[model samples]
Target: MAILKHFAVKNADYGAVIDYLKYQHDEFHLVPILDENGNSMLRDEFYFDGLNCNPEAFDLECELLNQQYHKNQRYDEIKCHHYIISHDPMDVADHGLTGEQAQAIGMEYAKANFPGHQALVCTHTDGSNNSGNIHTHIIINSLRKEDIASQLYTERAIDCKAGYKHHLTKEYLRHLQGSLMDICQREGLYQVDLLSPAAEKITQQEYHAQRRGQLNLDMANMEIMAEGIAPMKTKFETNKEKIRNAINDIAERAKSFEEFQRLLKAEYGIQVKDHRGRFSYLPSDRQKFISARKLGSHYDREYLLQLFEENALAAEQNQAQWVQDDPITILFIKSDLRLVVDLQNCIKAQQSRAYAQKVKISNLQQMAKTVAYIQEHGYDTQEKLQDTTDTIQSKMAKARSDAKLTEAKLKRVNEQIHYLGQYLSTKSVYADFLKSTNKKDSRQNHADEIAKYEEALQFLKQHSPDGKLPTMNDLRSEKELLVQQKSAQYETYQYFRDYHRELQTVCENVNHILDISQPKQQEQKRLHQSEHSL
Candidate 1:
């Protein structure tokens, strides 16, 4: 996938942009390396308007633009624009193109799009995530240099003003994405739908928060390791994950709609507001509210309401079961239990097939080894060969049994871990709900909060009928145990699997020797019979 990102530089010093792009800086070290004298030591390529500018003369050209466009309105507004043409790492690798080639593509695109503009195009080989994604930076002055009116006449007359600011519109950006896609396809590079909406889009603020939170968690873990103590959970959870989990818990309950709204406010400190038929959530801690639609399809009004209806129908059909099992356990019984069973069966099938294939391959190789062994060792007696074959067959049978048992244990432990994780996640939301409080408000405010609170309550009842859930510590302990057990089982399974292959090889080798000897013996017997008859 390729992305087109644009940013405006408001700083008066255009030379700063040139220095950052051309020079080796610690902040952006992925670009190119420089020696003690500050000259580039790596293959960092830069181009500007076809031979008029080099890295050394880049600042001079930018300064000339500033000098020519002195009549521009304000120094605070954007003076120049920086556009990035970034390609996917996989695409770059698949295309077998250098960073320079990628930069040239961006440069050509920029020139064609922004004619009569002084621009510096620099291609980079690495991305912020340390992935070797090929990207190009095209920094162009905001000032339009050419007399557009004199050059050409169109439906909309071009501004011939000396210092007209170049406007970037949505249509232009869309065009850039389409153009890049075409270029990628033509080059036979791996491409994705750059213009389509993403499945989940994380906002810049949330992204930064997650990164910061992860860094803090890492530092905390290091400290804990040094102290030989258990680490504590960080309070900084990304809103997206928190909200998604909360919504999932609520959706699963699917009680009355009114109860759903009430519980949302009372439990989670999240006020679900309806605005012109659209549902939005406003967290107590944040002033801004986000649309439910933005969260995902599950959180959409219709989908959530449908879940409530389904829950009601299920309760009516099986009142005894519904009354006996809590919402959480019911959820497990209905979905997770069945899912785990199916997954275990699938894993078993896959393992069986894989084991058979491995054994077959090992047997074939062993047969070849057996021929060589017989030729070298001169094993002429059938009795000695039969003894060796029996021993190998016995070992192969045991190995197969051991491998199967170990794999089954591993699968069970994994399923337990998965179940425990979901249970803990759902429990955490309920814990938050228990801790929340409802305060007095105006009639209208009360009405709004009441609606959300009722809905939330219904959600809780449907998800957790018994109202009693496992503690976080209990869940965590079980999870740790299961994870450890899984690790141990996996090691054992691998060992047995390797041993099984060895046994298969030995068995095949013995069988091959027997096959060769039996054929020779039959031929000898026929020759003996013919001699007796004569």
Candidate 2:
């Protein structure tokens, strides 16, 4: 799925943009990584070209153009528009996309969109996420150099004239996405819907927050695991996710809309308010409420009301077969992918960085290992491969479900042990308070212990239901077994998940090879043509 992203550079040093595009930089520290010789580290693999200017003299040429046009003179003015078109990783893995081809595509796009602008187009093989996605960078000087005929998505007549500044409108961005969709169709590459709102949209801010939070949590977890303790949380949930979980919890349990509101406030401190026929949620931390429209259609007022009605109906019609015990699962974890038939012809010639190019070839060779894996697993046909994938996926699902169940049991055991220990330690104080002739004085002296004893007692009784206190040793034994079981189940789940991913990739590639049905891609192409035609 290729998507268009844009940024405006306020600084006049157009050289920095080209430099960053060609070198390695530390994203975490926001600095350039110098080599042992104290020079900027060159990027591993890239394809670069300039439009209406020399690649080596891009910075000088852009400055001269701006001087000639007397544009982008102010310190705060946007000097250049940086546009990124990131192609799907699957395009490289299956559809044979390469940096050189992507660069050519980006050059064509830049010419078509910003016809009279001096631009630099560069393509790189390695994304920051190491996703192996082919992406192109198109940086156009805000000052145009030559006049051109008016094209599609141009909002104003001045937009096509020389000496005029480049203007990016929302309509132009939509048209860019449409062009990408067309490219994907013509090349038979995978594409995603770029026209409409995603069913679940995470704002750019939330996405970055999640990434940083997950990074911090991972470091914390490493320290925790080094101490030989299993970290309580392996994933970090954002504020929006917390709200979603809170809503889901209350949604499942509450019998009515009124009950739902009460439960949300009581349990999660999330206030759901309705105004002008729309629902908004104000979490405890936020000053302003977030609308359901931002959250998703699932959390909309109409959808939630329908969910509430369905839940009520389900409770009234609860049948014996409505719920069933999960079948037991045995868990385990794979390796392999296929090499492209001809890699040399697609990618740029490996001349400058032999070691880096070798690394890429190594990855290709690693992908070749999949052929041996397929034969070893006796996956002679695509059907066999798909069937095995489905079976492993089922096992993975069962493993995850069982692991969660074990975790719940472990939590209960831990809670029981804590309360029981507290109750035992405070039992003598409470007993003495009861026996004292001046009960008021004794209660005052032992207030803390008495309070602790009663709180523990209440919790134990509620959890027990039958009002029976299980032995400490029994609880301890259960906790020990649960810890081991949880560890095993987690390992099993991870194993099956990796296995499923590897096998699924192979299945998808096979499907691609045989030109199997892809209705979604066809539909996307059809829509692009119908809607984007001038």
Candidate 3:
């Protein structure tokens, strides 16, 4: 019941598409213009051929389109020779109207919506023996020529240019969609609107897919966009290794799609749908999301296919993949893991700051109690009182200062944690990364680095005397040694990552190879089995 609208222009070479349809469906009568229930200038016609490719049907469609567009414009310079609008044919059959009746409704709708445009409507029906779907096509010519009244018997012919352009623009397309939606509602048909994709995360395929159902497209290949250029190509293997290492980076926290979707929607008015119920994913809400051919009723299949071919070629050149691999998918997994690790670190960092603040506050409170006790009992121990007071005052001043510093540090850390948490909430890359990394364990190599960092922190903390800070020199030397150790592990991680990327690339290619190979292998296995049985 969904309807889609697409616009296209046919050059002189294209002639008319209805004429082609006339030959395809050879059963129905093609009606003429003069006989229809409207006062239109063009000849009304119907299917001389059955439903799809009949001359009469083509002529009838043109006649209807002319009635809406040209009307009484006897001198319209540009005539729309062909326009095609097709829908699920079964909807028409349900109306219990013959093919002619369905064609009539389309013509009527065209006249009502595009008055003053030359309109032609064709209805194609798949018989009960076949699919039983009935669809209508409408072609409209958008230009008309103005006439000048000649004083005499037209001694000279007036040169008239077309007033309207041949093709529809964005505004016009929206108008088309609105009219179609209105028609669908009136006719009690099913309809769905598309969602656009995110701007920050723009990808070419995502952009193209959005346009597929809503616009007339030319074929463009995605390969061209996929091709890795100079710097990226030079370090392709190296960066690939980094990416793999990042992907395999230890996972500290994970959330299911349902949990994430709930959080995203509740926290940030976004809707996610897991196509096939795989996992909640934000659906693209853009014109490009729907393939022009997939746009309910108005999708032009041949035109869209041409667009896809062009897209495929462009994609191939850009990325230059030997086999098809979903790059967004790969990148998404890596990003998701990055977010998870960051989020976990954020929570831990927050706790550490909170603990530091609490310790500072408790220490300040205890120091304040000692000062109060000394002030209250000063007369009883006068001899030692002066020295004790001096010591307590120094300790109290330091405690107060430390407390203020701790509170300030905690406040800053809290702010950072809040901001990072917000960022992690919206970021899907982390979730994807979590899913991918969880699939394989690359934790053993990084484990030592993690242990060493923890050990350095512990050693620094343990060696520092109570209430004393470690010297900058000591901190610097400790950090330098840790960095040196981490660097070695980083190299190992890079090697493993590069090795993993190669494996993944091979695995991705294997899918395509197996698609063909599996059947042949099966065939050979069947032969072997038959031989053994014999």
Candidate 4:
């Protein structure tokens, strides 16, 4: 899977980014020893190019732009936005991806996204764990250097104008992710669901921490082995990994939120608390609690609780057990969600004269509004009103269902497009393998490539049972149609959700009226007493 990551570079030195891309910084940290006949050296398997600027003098060009725009002057101002697209390690073997190709892709992406900004595009094959993954680095000056045309990703007018500093928003990042996915699909590379959270999310910091820790542990293990002793612990695990394991361990077996919490505390020395509708966990070694937001969605409150409810009937049911089980009791105890309110039970309204009068006036006005609404909507009966609410809720739920289905169709189309590209691009390799007399050696040399060809062929064949595989244009056009339909369905879902909320509030108000609005004589006596008291 190709993952897209972002970083905001606030340092004033734009040359440092290019330097990091072009040279090795592992041990010497750019302290270079000149070769006999050369001034400097560049790293192996590294390709770099610039857009709207000279690659050799990116910093100077950016500085000139900054001066012209009068932006990025403050010390704390962000000078550049760094985006990295890391392809899956498997892409190298399966797709025969190269550094040059990745660099070209990065150049195209940067030129399309950051058109007005002076940008440097770099590709590396032997950096960041030496994982044999081809990744690209896209670094763009924060200030716009030209007044370029706007794109669908552009959110504001200033984004396309010169002299304005780049300020990326969440929407822009999501669009970039979508664009990255599209690029990966078109390029016949692996792609992940960037729109959703990962099952196990390791941040860049945590990833590097684990990498360094593992490296150090391997070194220590080597020394121990040199002494003819087997190291007891050869593997290293980060604190977050331990926490995640503990939480998943407890949540997989526990039946309720409380039981899960108790087991988590007793078994792992981890304390879990629901704070302001969210869960926060404190490990034994940490002073502060880490929010579930930092962790992936698999550890969040909604997911865990739902998992527990499903685990409750593990001994009996097979699928969606919670759907059959009643959650009303649990919700009434733990959740603020409710169907109705009891206005008569408000003790504060009964305690004071002025407050009582104010509440009564408000309740009378609400009751009048409720009546007017019921009459206006022709809901003359309680059952009819409730039926209307249920119908609207059902419609909202159906709209959401439609949106999910449409999104899934879009994803399928994306996969079909990817496999179609793979099928077409690898036909020559397959033909050569078939024609080669030394078939065994050829297959052994390109095992992953062979697998890629076979898997893509099988997938396309199955997807197109009629044996008429779709062309790239057909798949892309289908994707475009699905995207438009998905958006329309999402808008419909939003409209229904808003309408449901409005109707639900009216229904709750009607219930409140039912609770507080009493007989005329008794209500008059209560108001008369409150008037005298006031």
Candidate 5:
């Protein structure tokens, strides 16, 4: 599966990005590099276009634009944007797409997405810690090539164009992601959800930290190899994971917001603060507070509150049947919630695999049935078998069409569910902001939080104007129904696909047998005719 990571470079030299993509020396290596990963720091796969000049002279091209249009522009203005398109290592290896092919894909994507921009695309084979992930790097200048007058300009200039500046909004990013997924599907490559559920989302910082920690462990193993000593095993967790675990612990035991805050501070040394409407966590060791949303959906304020409510209700219902547990026991129970979530995910994945297996088995059985039917009905002639094959082909085509329609529907429904989920989860924050009386301080101190809440509220109002938000349960049920519909469509498509292939095979075998028997049948006819004449 492919994932995208991007950032805009402000006041940064384009040459630096080029150099990093082309050169091999790591002057400041943050992670250990394995020897087997090879010394070829840069893969020999790069592509570029739309510069109207040599790519090697891209820096000059950008500079010329700046000179022509914005010579007095601020030094801190964004000059370039760098995007990384990375694929899973196993998927890339299995697909066997060469680095050049990857580069071509990246180039096409960049050219299509960032039209009129000077861009260079490069494919890299060596990932962090020698992970062997194939990824592409696309660097494009931020300056507009066409001339136009806009609010930011008094007159049309060489480097300024109306609506040329890239807007890296959430909606825009989601569109790009969907486009990438479509490209992968067209290319018959494996892909996961680009816009995955919030629960499964992992920030880039957390991902890199986990990778770095793994590399550290790898380095320690290398040392053990050199010393000929027993290897030490130590479990490492990312900071986000640790925070998530801590939050889960507190949410499971506390019944109210105040209790939740008190227990978190007393038991975990973590401070929970509600700024305006958004909730953030500050660890005792850390001075900065991180937003709960950054951790995961489960740790988000609304979800945590929902869990507390559910726990309280369960306790009330089973008070006589339940026994009070100590803090340690409670901790163990809270930890089990994480395990349960993980187990549920595992079950879903297994169910998908089982469905696929069932499809394959059903196809085999149908193939066997087809063969038996052909023998029983004496479909010995090529014409009869050909007619049957054509019928099956028509059915297969219809199934494919149905599957495509179902997939499109599923995509739309899933997207709706995602946004609805986001709005519902952040609705409480928006409500809190509305009820707060210290508007001045709230706006000044909790600017980011307020902005997020307002954004969610705006999106909900725009998309769902009735001011009614679907409950989590309703969304989940809808999601499950859509998933089942998609799965059934997929199964139908696969069944016909496999049946068609098997029928073709059988037709070929039957044709070959008829070819061998034709001469003998002809000779027998001549012999019988001669005997009748005698």
Candidate 6:
């Protein structure tokens, strides 16, 4: 049985969120600590954050908090948190917990999950009828206020790297499901996926169809056509305009329709047809003369039409082949991939800083230990050692600060990677599905579908994938650069490891004062050398 499933956080004003929730459900009940007249004589702490606080007692406290903060300005600036710990109520009922009991269990789960986290927890009964699941809201003041030196709402130094305790990522939520599933086993609730799947499951066509309606396939074909045609760009409007301009240019010289048709067939190789028998515009002899003069040979009408249609279909077919190649490839090609670039850059920058910090910190620890040894154990070469120690300590402090900054960057990069992975995963699945399937439709419908997909692909090419457009070659080159960067990082890590170990050994020897060591100085020298190598 799986237990945990989906988790999300939204930043919003507390009051607005509460109001929305209140309005969204009529039967939704809110119990407060205070009476209707706003008096709080009752203070109960049976359950923290809504779990097992006696329902009667929970209601009282809720009322009290509401009365206490309804008019407070702080409520307007906080975010309301909500989550669900779902188990099949029917399954639980079979095990001994009734529907109300299951709802209570979920409420308790929510409450126990985030105690002392400055949050409000509540359970719902009619969750399934409302939204196919039972859940709880952990409404907390995004901005917390406490009398102690450390308060919940105070903005602490956020190492976004470390994430939050009560709040977590989609991945964390899935992990949390494990705990919930255990609870279900203990309480005899039906178990299911603890966290929702980390990736999206949408197919490419489905995803495109979400935004494009019925035209996704056409738009896709158009993109393929554009890819196939080397010299011509892949803009439908541009292509249409070019064709129209050619038509108008030929029309400008024609004194009659016959001459106009002859000019088109000979000069542009276009064959426009009305409901007449296959016929050429000019007299047979005159057309032959024009063909020799303009086209330098016998230009045939049927041959020109065939050539044009073949050219058009060839372009279209190549794009179709592109879509058919591999859905993941298309997804990789079509994503808003600028984030990937930005994240890669950020990670590289952070890794470099962390590497430098590791080296400097090791050197500083060495210097600190040596200085202490000189002061306590011996003073034969004290002054020089002290000077070196101070310098190392300073450098180490700077390194530690830099490392913190790097860690922050790495954390952000990781988060961005998670986001991009989800987006790309969903798109790839759908693209693959679209490429693998075929459908039957009227010829006109099929053509329209093709056109729609072409238009959508064009729009995606222009905008959705992020920043400026990149050529296929550019994508390959960028990947190559990332590979090189990774290699450089690996080298840095190697240097840090060897130097840090030597420094630690030197520092330990100095503490014992056993060998009257020159190792401390030697290690410091090595540290400097390593820095240069990086």
Query: Which has the higher TM-score value, candidate number 4 or candidate number 6?
Result: 4
Please, what are the lDDT tens digits per residue for candidate 3 over residues 24-53? 322222232332554323212334222222
Give the TM-scores of the predictions, in the order they appear: 0.49, 0.55, 0.28, 0.56, 0.49, 0.26
TM-score of candidate 2 versus the correct structure, residues matched by position? 0.55
- Pick the TM-score winner: 4
Q: In terms of TM-score, which candidate is stronger, 4 or 5?
A: 4
Computed on alpha carbons, the lDDT of every model, listed in order, comes to 0.61, 0.80, 0.41, 0.80, 0.67, 0.43
- Ranked candidates (lDDT, high to low): 4, 2, 5, 1, 6, 3
In model 1, the worst 10-residue window by lDDT is 332-341
Task: Compose the digit string of candidate 4's lDDT tens values, residues 170-205.
Answer: 788888888899999999999988988777778878
After superposition, candidate 4 runs with Cα above 4 Å error: 27-40, 317-534
Residue 393 lDDT in model 3?
Answer: 44
Q: Which runs of model 1 end up more than 4 angstroms from their true locations?
A: 24-56, 71-75, 147-162, 203-209, 234-267, 276-279, 290-534
**Tens-digit lDDT track for model 6 on 454-492?**
454454355423443333333343344444445555544
Per-residue CA lDDT of model 5 for 1-534, tens digit only, reads 887888788864666666667665442353222346554454344443433446777778777877776642577778888888997787666887767777778977886666666777777777644577788888877766654333221223433452245456666677778878988888877787878646735876667677678778878888988889877565567867777788888888888888788767644567788887678998755789998777777776777788889888887766534334222111211110000012233555467877656655654555555456467545777697787678768877887888788778667556666676666666676667678898777677767766766776566566543465444444455556567767887876677666666557666545444555698999999999999999
Clashes of 3: 107
Query: Mind giving the per-residue lDDT tens digits that candidate 1 earns over 1-534?
Result: 677777788887767776676555553223455788968653344433332356456667656766676633477878878888778788755668677678778777876666666677788775555557778888777776665543232223444444576667666666777778888788777677867654455654566677778878888888987989877775567877687677677657748776676656544556676678667887656789888767765676766778889988877878767546433212221111000012233555467877656655655555666555545434566565455445545654665665566566456445444444554445444444555563333324445444444554454445443464333343344445445555665554455445444434544556555666698999999999999999
- RMSD to the hidden true structure, all candidates: 20.6, 29.4, 31.2, 28.6, 27.4, 34.6
- Once fitted onto the true fold, the runs of candidate 6 whose alpha carbons sit more than 4 angstroms away are 1-13, 16-78, 96-99, 128-133, 143-175, 193-534
Q: Candidate 2 residues 1-534, lDDT tens each?
A: 887777788999888988888998876544788999999989899988999999879999989888887888899999999888988888887988888788888988888777888899999899865667889999989988998888888889898888898888889888888888888788787888888755455765677788889999999999999999999899998998788888888888777777788768755667888788887998866899999878776776887888899988887666323333211112212443643333344344454466557656764565456556666666788787777788879989999999999999999889999999999999999988888999999888888999999999998998874467766866776677688889999998998888777777776555543442377778888999999895
lDDT of 1: 0.61
Backbone clash total for model 6 is 38
